[model samples]
Target: MRSMEVDMIRTLETDKAPKPLSAYAQGIEIPPGHRVVHVSGQVGVTLDGQIPADPARQHELAWENALAVLAAAGMDHTHIVDAHCYITERSHLGIYRATRDRFLKGHRPAATLLIVAGLADERLVVEVDLVAAAGAAGPAT
Candidate 1:
């Protein structure tokens, strides 16, 4: 197996959405010799794998999951360079922004928000995909 080293990866969200499901940013900073982590779409679920019903709550869960993945790999929000968010309810954009602000604080990554028909899970109101880089300075713009 091949192993790699990383310096730092940060995760951030505005009041817009919850933290991402991975230790990736809504965007990333990368240095040379780095590997980018591509996280799959994550729904709002508890650590034990309990899914939430509320659209806003589900967003929170998805974000938390993303962060957990990043931390496990020695990364955080700051390392995220790109993000994809899927929302079932178009009106949830406001909630997303609020939550994002709460989580990201200031750092905003390059992101695309989509209003989808549905997600993998029905109760899941939102799902997020993230891109994180390790062994680099930061994400590439």
Candidate 2:
């Protein structure tokens, strides 16, 4: 029997737009034979079970939580292809964008932002979910 090797993933960064903060790349490219990973919406609650009162802090925590989930799936920020962000208040958009830009750095993945009435927890001001893809060594199932 013969073995097969999977190609590595690639990232795309361009000078066309503002530079990313440093946490992520401007874009990511997943080859044809890759596996996709989906991370559920993550709230602002910390590992210690504490949710910050400030919206900005909440936004940061949410992104951190989402990143952690992606890491658990054997992927990183560079593998992210899309993200969805939810904010409880319109006033928090600026803070949310700043936090997101910082966390994502230069990774310009497909994204969506929505202002919702509330989250599963009333104290949570922000929630974020992500999708990532990585090369798979095995044949497509």
lDDT to native, each model: 0.70, 0.77
- The local lDDT score (0 to 100) that residue 82 gets in candidate 1 is 77
Q: List the residue pairs that clash in candidate 2.
A: 20-105, 24-107, 25-106, 25-107, 26-106, 26-108
Cα lDDT tens digits for candidate 2, 1-141: 221222465556667776655344455567787889899999988799998887787888889999998887777776678788899899987798789888877666767788999899888888899988876763233
lDDT of 2 at 108: 62
Candidate 2's C-alpha runs over 4 A off are: 1-31, 137-141
RMSD in Å for model 2: 7.3
Q: Can you write out model 1's per-residue Cα lDDT over 1-141, one digit (the tens) per residue?
A: 121223643333365656554333443345567778888887788978888667788888888788777776677776666777889898998887777666665646667888999988677888888886656544332
TM-score of each: 0.72, 0.75
* Model 2 residue 60 distance off true place after TM-score fit, in angstroms: 0.9
